[model samples]
Target chain A: MNLTILGCYAATPRTFTNPTSQVLEIRNRLFLIDCGEGTQVQLRKNKIKFSAINHIFISHLHGDHFYGLIGLISTFNLLNRNNDLTVYGPKGIQEIIKLQLKLSNSWPQYDLHFVELTSTESEIIFEDDKVIVKTIPLKHRVYTNGFLFQEKIKERKLNVNAVQNYEIETCYFQNIKSGKDITLEDGRVIPNSELTFDPEAPKSYAFCSDTMYNEEIIPIIKNVDVLYHETTFLESEVELAKKTMHSTAKEAARIALQANCKQLILGHYSTRYESIKLFKEEAQTIFENAVLGDDGKVFEL
Target chain B: MNLTILGCYAATPRTFTNPTSQVLEIRNRLFLIDCGEGTQVQLRKNKIKFSAINHIFISHLHGDHFYGLIGLISTFNLLNRNNDLTVYGPKGIQEIIKLQLKLSNSWPQYDLHFVELTSTESEIIFEDDKVIVKTIPLKHRVYTNGFLFQEKIKERKLNVNAVQNYEIETCYFQNIKSGKDITLEDGRVIPNSELTFDPEAPKSYAFCSDTMYNEEIIPIIKNVDVLYHETTFLESEVELAKKTMHSTAKEAARIALQANCKQLILGHYSTRYESIKLFKEEAQTIFENAVLGDDGKVFEL
Candidate 1:
């Protein structure tokens, strides 16, 4: 799985800083998350195919999280998109989008669907054969959800050399990969363990942002491959972070440490900071393997 | 008066090209005309102070014209803006903006006002002591208005040397500047023309865009110092222009010629054209003083 950081700043977008938005590539599917202003331009700059995105996951209704959504939706219609697209977001999102489209008199020619979220509890919102996305209830100024995307476990791999020792026919290869014993023509049976090996373990990624220090989410995101959490402030501005219901770098690291994720990615820095180095430094002091999330940076897990 | 072109392309924004938006500086006031996506960033890149802009004019309800407005408004609130802001646009604009703000729950601390337009005939929409803005009804696929920003007639300049020669009190100087004859204590009347020189003639700028080849607006914008018109196509694509309710470069020049404006600006070119030079060449065929409008290019009138 790979993730592209399109924007990482908080509150407002400056000349060089953008607001929160990113693209996640998992199992050959492209998903857009938290589209801030200028995200469409960032997509063009990054050369990401617009049509490749069939699903959008929005964490909340804040302007920084979804202001660019309507424009992107309008551009899709302009581009003659006829494919089905679904947006999963908080309850009010459907009203906001439909209102603009209604007033503009330019509704999408294709089917547009919305999976509105009202439950404050964690729940699975999207699932495919390859992956399942579940909401991680987060504490913020508003009702919010952080997504946990987990790839489904794969089938067992055939031990090609070990299978050769048996008189297994080509038609029985499916049974071998399915972790089942294959019986020979003379009624002698071979154990499935001798013919197949376990596939690589499935990986998962947890995305959390714009939330305060909440210990309840640790259990939901614990032991994920990568946990990306918002670090809106450094240790020096802990008070501001608390007042805004945002997490400081130290707080995010504490969550990461408690959650015991393999890797921690820190992002969504306030524009007041001159550099993002302090976020990494502060986050790493509490949790090792903490990396700064910068715009245009890509991370693979 | 100064005019700065922010983005002048037609339809949608590209990686390097932007949609329609511009800034007009007149009488120490800055007015934003049409705010496409990324306009706030363009304002910052152009070094235009956001606080200095109290009035915004949106020509239409199309996404290209006003998609950036909510983000800019939210940014203004984030910057702690307390000054009042006024927006003038089509009838449905207020509803669209209000809906988004309601969903985001971010009401502006500053006073926000809207002037909705639905008339098909020309009318004065905004007026102050130094300038007046009127709507120039244009034919388009949607309801659109072209703005005519005309500076109010300036006061006559005082001849400092000529004024000192008379025994006129400082309080009477206002009367002299108002073009009234002054009377000395001895009842000797001095002609105002002899004591003062006429100030420079008031200059006006007419912005017409996203319109077809309609002659109805020629009289309303006639004899303006500068006329900026949208030329969405070349003469070769006149049929496309007619179908889209957009004008060709040649048609824009024909309007400039018929309106008898001092200068003509051709902009809003379709991205299909590789070079912008062709627009100027085609426009100059009908109007001698046609100039190409480019993003970031400033004009003084």
Candidate 2:
């Protein structure tokens, strides 16, 4: 799985910094997360194929989080994109996009679908054969949710040397990979484990932003391969963070440590900070695997 | 009056070109016209002071004309702007903005006033001591109108040298500047023309875009200092222009010529043509004073 960070700043978009937006490529599928303003430009700069993004996951309806969605959709129409696009966002997102289209008197030629999430409880929002996405209920000033993308386990790999020694038929390899014992022509039962090795462990990523420090999401995002948490403030601004329903770097780090994530990506830094090194330094005090998220940075898991 | 072209290209926003948008500075007042997508970034790149823009005039509800408006308004709120902002546009703009604000659950701390235009005939939308803004109804697919910004005639010059030479009292200078006959303390009648030269002639700029070839608006925008008209296509694509309710360069220049404008600024060129020189060349065939509008290019009228 590969993750591309298109933008990873907090609040308003600046010349150097952008609001939250990212692309996760898993199992040959591209999933867009939190498309903020100027996301299409960022996507162009990152050299990502616009049509490859089939699904969009919006965490909330905040302007910085999803203002670019309507523009992007309009651009797709202008470019003559015919593929169906699925948008998973908060309840009001569909209305906003519809209003824009109505006012402009422009409609897309492609099939546009909206999956509004009105549920307050944690649940699976999207699922396919290889991937599953769940919502992580978060505490914020408005109704907001984090996304957890978990890749499902794959089929067991064939043990070539073990298969050679055992006169295994090529036609039976499929059964063996499916973790089933196959009986050979010699009337000998062979164990599936002896003929095949275990499949590689699936990786998972959790995206959380614009939320206060909440331990309630720990169980849902526990032991994630990577966790992107918003650190909108520093240690000195803990009071401000609480008041704004945002998390400080130290608070994000504490959540990362509690979740036992292998790697912690700190993002959504307030515009007040000139540099994000302080957030990394502060997060690392509690979680050694903490890293600062920057625009255009990509990660492979 | 000075006009700064933020973006002039038609249709979609591109890497090197932009959609329709411009800033007209008249009498120290900045008026933003037709804010397309990416307008805020263009404004930042141009180093325009945000606070200086007190009024925004949108030509129509087309996406290429006003897509960036919501983002600009949101940014103003994010910056904690307390000054009142006045937006003038066609009917339904208020509902669009209000819906966005409602979805985001954010109401600006400052007052946002909207002046919706429903008049099909020429009507003054905004007027002050220094400037007057009137709408010039146009033919288009949607409810559209062009804006005419005319700087009011300046107050007569004090004629400091004449006043001192004529031994005129300072109190009577106001009357002299107002073109009134002033009676001096010495019982001498001073003609206003002798005391002061004519004030600077009123400069007018007419912005007509996203409209078909319509000569009906000529009388409304007659004898304007500068006329910016949309030339979405070349003469070769006149059919497409008619189908899209747009105008060709020659057609736009013809309208400018009929209006007897001092200068014609050709803009809103279709993205198909890479070079805008063709637009100017074609327009010059009809109007010799025609010039191509370019992004970031400024014109003084």
Candidate 3:
């Protein structure tokens, strides 16, 4: 799994900082999340192909989260994209995008689908043979949701030498990989564990941003390989963070520590802060594996 | 009059080139025109204060023309801007912006006014004591208008030496500046021309963009001091220009020549070109004063 941060600032897009947008590549599929203003330009700067984005997940209706949706959709139409595109966002997202397209008279030729999300509970939004995507309800000033991407457990790997030594037929190889015992022609049964090895553990990632310090999300994102949480402020500004329905760095770290996430990525920093390293320092006080999420930062897990 | 080209490319914004957006400073008031995506960042890069802009003129509803508007407005609210903002655009612009704001639940604290335009004829849209802004109707894929910013004729300058020599009272200075002859206490009428010199000729600038080669705007923009015209394509791609309802470089030059504009600024070049200098070469073949308009390029007229 690979994750690319296209933007990781708060409020508005600045000359050197962007609002909030990221690309998560899992099982060779790219999923976009929280397309803030200037996302397309950020994509260009990062050399990410526009055609690779098939699914976009928005956290909320805030401009800092989804203002770039209409422009990105319009660019897709201008490029003559024909593949189907799906957007998973807040309830009013479809209306906002469709209204702009209608006014511009530049509807997409491709199939554009919207899954308007209003659910306040964790529920699967996308599922396939290799991966599953579920929503993590978040507390914010508006209706918002974070997404959890989990890779499905893979089939057991065949131990070729062990299988050949056991005289397992080709037909029985499939059963052995499926964790089933193999039956020989001599009416002897061979244990599946003797012919196959356990597959690598699956990885999971949870993205939560633009939310307050709410512990209710811990249950939904527990034991994730990686957790990206918003650190819009430092502990010094904890009061402001709470008043504005945002989380401070220490608060995000506390949530990560309680949730048992392997690694914590801090992002959506308020532009008022002089340096983002301060957030990492503050988060590290609670979680040892806390790291700063800067624009264009890439992580391979 | 000062004109700053925040973005001048056509179609979609790229890694280096931007879409259509500019700032026109007339009589010390900044007027934003055609805010494409990434405009706020561009404004920041150019050091143009967001608070200085009180009026925005959108030529059309095309995404390349006005997609950045909603984000800019939202940023204004975030910045706590308290000044009034007026937008003049096509009839549906108000609905489009208001709908986004409503969905985001981020209504502006300042008074937001919209002047929806539906007229196909040229008419005055903004007027003040020092300047007059009139729409120059243009033919495009959508309802479009080019803006003509004419600096209203200034009052005659006071000849300080001549006035003092005549011992003109301060109370009569206003009348003298208004081109009224001064009458001495002895009933001797002083000629207005002798007391004051003519002010510098009022300058004018017309912004024409996203329009095809049409002569209908000649009367409206005739004899303008400077004209910024869209040159989306070179003469070699005239066919595509017609199909897209965009003007070619030579075509823009032809319009400038026919309109008798003193200087022609060519902008909105298609990103397909390897060099923007070709546009200037082609435009200058038809009009001597034609110049290329680049992102961040400023013009003082």
Candidate 4:
């Protein structure tokens, strides 16, 4: 799985920094997360194919998180995109998009679907054969939810040496990969575990932003391979972070530690800071595996 | 008056070109015209002061014309702007804006006033002491209007030698500048024409875009000092222009010529062609004083 940070600044779009937006590619499927203003331009600048994005996950209704969605949808129609697009977001997103389309007298030629989240409890929002996505209920000033993308477990890998010596029938190879015991033509029972090894561990990523530090979410995102959490403030601004419902770098690190995530990615720095190194330093004091997210940066898991 | 082109290309925004948006500075007031997508970035790249633009004029509800407006407004709120902002646009613009704000849960601290236009006939939309803005109805896919910004006639320059020789009273100077014959306290009468010339012929600029070639608007924009019109297609693609209710370079120039505009500015070139210089060349066939609008290019009128 590969993750690309299209934008990671807090508050507003400036000459050097942009608002929140990113792309997560898992099993060749592109999923857009938190489309802030100027996101389409960032997509173009990064050479990401606009048409490849079929699913969009919006964390909240905040303008900084999803203001660019309408324009992106309009542009897709202008480009004659015919593929159906699915959008999962908090309630009221559909109304916002519909109003703009009505005022403009333009409608998409393709099917547009919206899955509005009105529930405060965690639930599976999207699922397919290869991946499953669930909501991570977060504490914020408004109703908001983070996303957790987890890759599904795959078939076991064949052990060539064991298969050669166990007199395994070629027809039973499928059963062996499925972790089933099979009887060969020689009337000998073969154990699937002896002929095949377990598949590579599934990778998972958790995304949280615009939320205060909450340990209640630890169980939902525990043992995630990678965790991207907003660190809007440094240690010096903990009071401000709490007041604004934002997390300081130290607080973000504490969440990552409690969740026992393999790695931690910090983003959504306030526009007041000139550099994000301070955030990294603050996070590192509590969690060793902390990295800062900047515009156009990418990570592979 | 000075005009800065933030974006002038037709169709979708790309890495090299942007959609319709511009900045017009008249009498120290900055007016943003037609904010397309990515306008905030364009404004930043051009180094425009965001706080200075208190007035925005949207010609139509098309996404290419005002898709970036919500994002810009949200940015203003995020920046904690307290100044009042006035937006002039089509009748349904208020609903679109209000819906977005409602969904985003963001409210600006500043006062935002909207002047909705439903008239199909030419009318004065804005008027200040130094400038007057009138709407010129145009034929398009949607209800649209072109804007005509005319600078008010300036006070006549004092002819010091003539005033001294004629022994004109100081109080009579105001009447003379108002283009009226004035009599001094000593009973000496002076002809206004003999004392002062016409106030430098008030300069006017007419902006017409996303419309087909129509001669009906000539009277409303007649004798404009500078005319900026959309030329979405070249001579070779004139058929496309007619089909899309857009105009070709030659067609735009024809309107400028029929209106007797002093100079013609061609813009909103379709993304099909790479070179915008062709628009100027094609327009110059009928209007010699024609120029192409490029991003960041400024024109003084």
Candidate 5:
């Protein structure tokens, strides 16, 4: 799995800084997250093909989180896209998109689908043969959800040496990869473990943004390979973080540590800060593997 | 009057090239016209203060023409704007803005007023002592209106020598500046034209975009100081212009020549063009005073 941060900031898009938006590539599927204003421009700058985006996941309806959605959709139409697109977001997201399109008198030539999510509990939102997407309910000023993208384990690898020693037929190799034991022609049964090795463990990534420090999501996102959490404030601004329903750098680190995630990515830094490097220092005090999220930065997980 | 081209291209906004949007500063009031996406960022880049913009005029509901409006308004709210904002657009514009604000639960803290226009005929949409804004109906795929911003005739300048020659009383100076004939204390009648010259001839600027080569508007926009017309295509692509309800550079120049506008500004070039200088060259062939519209280029009239 690979993640590219198209934009990672709070409030508004500046000439040099962008708001919250990113692209996650898992199992050959490119999924867009958040899509703040200027996202399409950033996507172009990042050299990502427009047609590669099929699924868009919005955490909330805030302008910084979702304003670029309508523009991107309109751009898709102008590009004459015919591929089906799916959008998953909060309840009112669909209404905003449809209203804008209606006013513009423009409609997509593709099948545009909307999946409005309102549940505050963790639930699966998307699934395919290669990947599974689930929601990590978060606490924020508005209704919000974090997304967890997990890859599915593939077929077990076959041990060619073990298969040859067992004198198994070539047609039975599929059974061994499916974790089935093969019966020899001499009336002897060989264990499937001897013939096949387990596939690589599935990797998972959890994105938690615009949320306060909530421990309830730890169980749902436990042991994720990477966790992207919004650190809108520093440790000194704990009260401000609480008032705004945002997490401080240390608080985000605490959550990442408690969830046992391998690495923590901190972003959505407030413009009030003189520098964003302080976030990395503060988060690293609690979680050793903390990386600051920067626009156009891609991480391979 | 000063005009700043924020974005003047057809189709989607690119990394360096923006779509349709511009700022017209007249009478100490900054008016935003046709706010495409990424306009706010452009405003920041141009160092135009957001609070100075109290009025926004959207030409049409096309995404390239008006997509940046909501984001700008939302940014105004985030900046804690207290000044009222007025928007003039087509009939459904208010509903679209209100619906998006409602869905996000983020309404403006200031007074937001909308003047919905459904008129196909020329009519004044905004009027103040210093300026008058009227809609210039245009033909497009959607309902579109260009704007004509004309400065109201200012107070006549006082010619001290002429006033003294007629022995006009100091108290009558105000009346003379207001274009009223003054009867001197010596019972001498002096014409107002002798007392003062016209105030800069009341400079006018007409913005006619996203329209065909319709000559019916020549009467309304006749003899304007400056006219910014959309030249979406070159002379070679006249057929495409006719089919898309757009105007080519030659056609735009034809309208300018017929209306006797002081200067013809060509803009809204289609992305298919390899170079924009061709538009200026093509337009200059028919109209001598033709200028090209480029993003961030300011024209003082």
Candidate 6:
């Protein structure tokens, strides 16, 4: 799995720094997260294929989070997109998008679907054969949800030596990979474990942003391979962070530490700070495996 | 009068080329015209003060024309703007803006006003002491209008040497500047023309974009000092331009020539072209004072 940071700044987009937006590549599928105002341009700059994105997840209805949705949808229509596109966001997102499309008279030719989320409980919102996505209810000034993506268990791999020793038939290979025991031609039973090796461990990633320092999400994102949390402020601006329903770097690190995440990625920095190194330093003081999420930075998980 | 090209391409914003947007400065007042996506960031990059823009004119409801408006307004609120802002656009623009603001829950602290226009005829939309703005109705796929920014006739110059010879009192200077004949204490009446010289001729600029090659706007924009016209196609794509309701460089030049404009600025170029010089070359074939409108390029009219 890999993640590309298109934009990671907060509140408003600047000339050098963009607002919140990123692209996650999991199991050969690309998912867009939190499209800010200049996200489409950032996507172009990052060289990510626009058609590769089939799903977009918006954390909230704030301008910095979802203002680019309409423009993106319009551009998709202009590009003659034929595949279906799905957007998962707050309840009012559908109205905002539909209204703009109607007024602009540029409705998409492809099927555009909106899955409005209002549940405060963690629930599965997307599920496919290889992966599943669940909502991590977050505390913010508005109704918000962070997404958790987890890969499903893969099929068992064949142990070539063990299969040859057991003299397994080619026709029985499918059953053996499905964890089924094989019956030999001489009426002897062979355990599946003897012929096959265990599957690779599944990986998981959770994205949380534009939220306050709330520990309620720990259970939903516990022990994930990678946890990306918003750190809109430093410890010095803790009071401002609280008032704005944003988290400081130290607070995000504390959550990452308590949740037992393997690695923590810090982002959504306020433009007031001249350097993003401060966020990584503060986060690392609490969690050793913390890294700063700068624009155009890619991480292999 | 000064005009700044913030963005001048057509259809969609790209990595290097932006969509339609510009800033017109007349008599010390700034007017934002056609705010496409990333316009706020473009404004910052161009060093234009956001607070100086009190009025915004949106030509149509297309995404490329006004997608950045909501984000700009939200940014204004974030910056704690206290001055009033007025937007003039098509009839449905108010609904589109108000719905987004309501969903985002970020109403501005400043007074936000919208002037909805539904008239098909050319009419004055804004008038102040120094300048007047009129809607130059154009032919487009949607309801669209071009803006004409014209400086009002200035007061006659005092002709400092003539005033001193006449021994004009300071109290009557204002009247003299207002083009009134002055009466001395000895009951001698001096003609206003003898005391003052004629004021500099007023300058005018017309912005026509996202429209076809229609001659209906000639009367409205005739003899303007500067005319910025959309040139979305070259001569080879004339049929496509006709079908898309856009203008070619040759056609834009034809209109400028017929209208007798002092100078023609060509913009709204399609990204398919490798060079913008072709537009100026084609336009200059018919209009000698034709120029290309490039992003970040300023023009003194």
Error of 2 at B164 (Å): 4.3
Candidate 2 Cα misplacement greater than 4 A, ranges: B161-166, B183-190
Clashing pairs in 6: none
> Is candidate 1 or 6 superior in TM-score?
6
| All candidates: TM-score | 0.97, 0.96, 0.98, 0.97, 0.98, 0.98
Task: Report clash pairs, candidate 4.
Answer: none
Q: Residue B212 error for model 1, in Å?
A: 0.9
Better of 1 and 2 by lDDT: 1
| TM-score for chain B of each model, two decimals | 0.97, 0.97, 0.98, 0.96, 0.97, 0.98
Clashing pairs in 5: none
- Tell me the spans in candidate 5 whose CA falls farther than 4 Å from its real position: B165-167
Q: Give per-residue CA lDDT, model 2, range A184-267, as digits (tens).
A: 788998888899888999999999987999999999999999999999999999999999999999999999999999999999
The CAPRI-style docking tier of model 4 reads medium
Return model 2's CA RMSD, one decimal: 1.8
Question: Fraction of true contacts kept, per model?
Answer: 0.71, 0.44, 0.79, 0.81, 0.73, 0.74
> Is model 3 an incorrect, acceptable, medium or high docking prediction?
high
lDDT of 5 at A293: 97
Model 1, global lDDT: 0.91
Better of 2 and 3 by DockQ: 3
Better candidate number, 2 or 5, judged by DockQ: 5
- Angstrom error of the Cα, residue A125, model 4: value is 0.6
Q: What local lDDT does model 4 show for residue A225?
A: 95
Instruction: State the lDDT of candidate 5 residue by residue for A186-208, as single tens digits.
Output: 88889999999889989999999
lDDT of 4 by residue, A1-301 (tens): 9999999998877777888999999988999999997788899999899899999999998878988899899988988998999999998889889888877888899899999998888899999999999999998888899999999999999898998887676777888888898777778887778888989999999999889999989999999999999999987898998898999999999999999999999999997886799999999999999998999999988
